[model samples]
Target: MNDSPGWASPGPAPSDGRPPENSGGSGPAGGAPESTPSGAKWSKEQPPAGQWSAPGTSGQRSHAQTPRPQGWNGAPQGGGWGAPGPGGWGGPPPAAKPGVIPLRPLGLGDILDGSVSTARAHWRTVLGVTVVVAVLVQIADIVLQRFVLPAPMEITADPESNPTEALRQSLESMQDSMISLVPSLLISTVGTLFTTALLTIVVSRSVLGRSVSLGDAWREAKPRLPHLLGLTLLLSVGAMAILTVAALPGLLLGSVGGALLSAFGVLAASVLVIWLWVRFSLASPALMLERQSIGQSLRRSAKLVQGSWWRVFGIQLVTALLTFLVSMIIVMLFSTIALFTDGSGMGELLTGNSPEFGWAFLVISSIGAVIAACITYPISAGVSVLLYIDQRIRREALDLDLARAAGLPGYGTEQPADHTPGS
Candidate 1:
């Protein structure tokens, strides 16, 4: 069974993973990249004020010998002359010191930066396939709308015409029709495969520098399907069970009692459901890519997310808001134009009855998908993969892998050599 569903068909993939460690090299402005080791720079042992060297001169002088790097003017290239300002009166901006890890926090900007870098590296795979997949799926939608739905409508409308009843009946028929088809089941099964593997492969290849083909993603995903399916069924049953518990009053008592309690039950169930969702959101990556079993992966996800729940939730919330607002704005703009512009009308036009339905909505959505994938897929993958990396860093001291990948300068098996930007 080919695991390559619509997502990974010989195209660009979004990048994701832990950021590689920097070699402690400085850029022109003296800023170190995120990948640099925290202990990058070297600081010297301080001497007494009386033994301080004069600015631009090497000999030990007086109690306030050097005027500091700033006031001294044109201090030489080597690392000797700088000092505390007058009477140790605070320094000259601390001589442009390098940053320390104690000062590091996982800011929104850092995750967003990781996301952006991931995309830059793997966007081609993402774009090439999303457009094609979306087009094919939507064309199937179009064909269904154009040819298939009309006959059922005609049969129900002709004055034997219980028009409203016929419409309702047709809808019921369609609903029954949808759930039982073999092809649909196959599509759904394949879709599951796509969701689990393609994204991970793209991400791993992009961030971890692994070379993965569509074939590779599929084969890797195959053995995991049973486990994934079990997880899915488990979640579905769990959700229904919770909802059923919530609806117990309605189920056994009078309608009034059930109605009164239903809302609260739903609220409680929803909270639990959301908690579970976040807890397991990264589990697919763990199971599919990391080769962990269902129970183990869930535990791993929870552990990785232990201190970062709010941050992860916030990141997802932002992604949702952006996806919703942007997709809506574009769709509505096309819809408004269709409503007002000559020949751009929809509705009856969709039944081939006033004007054009502005098919660009399809294309616009496709573009939105690509942009969304570019922005989000990588972030999602990167965060999960980076969490994996962070675990390794903590356990195996794998910051060395990150440094090597990033091509950082001056890192080794032994202690890292301290560096000063100029020195």
Candidate 2:
């Protein structure tokens, strides 16, 4: 693509998800690598595992949308390559479409569109699975909230006019909430993570055009449990560490300096954490699809993610923002009264408490969560998987495999014969 890296030939193992001979992620524009990714990859036989690149790029996002090899010319077409017109030798034919660049690299629209399309294509399955997961997760939340909490009677506080007294009351309230939430939070976190992992696998398979069942998804994720747990621990520990460090540095400062310095420190820490998050975002897919180790997955992700960090982040942001807006619209329709809080911000009442719309609040809150979950979960999962593809496209020339999978013409492989070492 553009001036990005040149594509590396695959090594010995041909991954079911990608052509193995293409360690670079992109095959030579003229020919597919002889390395099939179907078996275990010999990491040593691969490139130095340093930086990766792709080759044979062309056509900037032209003013008018280019015709997709299939119809609907306006839809984002995967980049194309063709018979080398006397310029170089032949290999994996670049995307078949004429006048297209092999390295069109993904854009924001490309990613989100893929996400929505994946969702829409499997909306029934996604919605059904999301609802099931949300119900289970929410049921767990309620059980934790109602039964497992320390009795609200554990401590008492006196309402008072004094500011210090009121502050104490607030802290006590927050503390109680947190204390009661501990067990449930832990459970919910685990449940949510598995849900995230499963959803991620589904989205990945959906994008990859493989048939997947809920059972299949769970089976896929089962082996990766420890790595996923390790990732969670890393993030939680890192966050706490940063907050602790930030707080320590500011304890000596007065409120004003402390606030300023702590905010700066926290902000810096956040940026670093965000970068790490993005780098590891593709780890799960790498782990499952490629059967990589935790360390190997992390490094593979980092290698692919080197130059396109901002683009990946932008894709996530746009998806989250879009889903948030949808959630807000639901809130406005069903929880208008809850949004009707008093000037003090504590005077609002739900219809469950009021004769008017009490049921509306309960319904809105429950239904809203499900609706939001359905929309948000799939999109988030889709975007993450799409990010994996986007990285490969930029670094390894994944677009070629994608074109083949989509069955667009000109890729032209006929089962085993076409399966020759790099095809």
Candidate 3:
């Protein structure tokens, strides 16, 4: 191999199992003759070999000999031909880094750092999309909580005096909780869908060291929104179905034994749901970047995750935990402040009453929610996109394609065309 970075070429392989002709051998003469094909050739008009000093030596060359031209035979001045330069002979070239990450298989740190770097580099676009989606979603949630959803049922039941009435009140409270939860869940899901789609584009461009705008991301992501929504709904329904099936038998039996069995079933079902969720976690990026059908994207994700399930799951879990912690901190701080500012909320807490939050409390808490969403959305989306890219780099040698796409030289001869994301 040549001793140059990014320009090394493989030597010719022997046609048969034997070594090539003229290669050095343990012969009486110590090797092949000077005329052999593999032997180094010397110029006819060469200076005396001993006259020039060896590279890196302090000894001076004979002044009688003529000075060689600067950068003779591609070597820097004062260096022997083919001598080692700053990088020693045959060292691997540094990976190309056009954007947030180097085009290579990524480690956990690389994945996390890349996500943050992408968001930081493209804060205008990244924050813009996330903030808008977060604000809209929070507004909808606040409106639903304050006006559309029913008020919290008063739990005035005294089980000692009226057991039946207490049971009925408990059921009503559960019903109200579900009613409130469903709308919030739906709103959050919609918000995630849009942010995921838009931020995926931003992250993709950032990987290629390119800047993108909110308009550009929307234009690129608009076509894939419906498919993404379908994917989200499909995953949600599948999980719900699993849980329902697990608990149905217990509910129908209405006995202690059946309830025990149902609990076990639900536990097992939860494990299965988690496994499947991680297995298909990369589907969103695959769908958006590859422009693939929902089925194909799921399959692609499964294939990428097949052997590295634990690694992918661990990375995703860590990301989720970090985001959750950050959001919790922000929400808790604001909620605490809100409690002090809203007299009714403070009174309800003090009296151990169900808090009927007023508009002041709701608006303050919503602001916290908006801020949390803005921070978490970009991070979550960035990690997902980067995980997908990391998996592809490991499995498909995607770094080469990424390097080419970034217009890095020495990767390929042909120029990259305008292809789909990840193509």
CA deviation > 4 Å runs, candidate 1: 1-106, 136-196, 208-233, 251-257, 334-380, 387-398, 404-423
Q: Residue 83 deviation, candidate 1, in Å?
A: 11
Where model 3 places Cα greater than 4 Å from the true spot, the runs are 1-91, 156-158, 161-172, 413-423
The model with the greater lDDT, 2 or 3, is 3
Q: Candidates' lDDT values, in order?
A: 0.47, 0.57, 0.74
lDDT of 1 by residue, 291-410 (tens): 667886677667656665675666656755765676577556655554554344455666666343455544554454444433444455555544444443443333333333323332
**Candidate 2 to truth, TM:** 0.65
On lDDT, the leading prediction is 3
TM-score of 3: 0.75
* Backbone clash count for every predicted candidate, in the order shown: 12, 38, 0
lDDT by residue for model 2 (1-423), tens:
111111122233222345344344332222333544786442221211111222324545221222223211212212332235586533232233211122246667766776777677666666667888777876676565556664653344566546555555655677677777777667667765776677666666565455567777777677777877876777677777876686667645635566567678878878887888877777766665565667877777776666667866777667778878987786565455444423222233332232332333444455666667777777777777767766666555455555555454433323544465764
- RMSD (Å) of each candidate, 1 decimal: 13.2, 10.4, 12.6
Instruction: Write down the lDDT that model 1 would get.
Output: 0.47
Report the poorest 10 consecutive residues by lDDT, candidate 1: 95-104
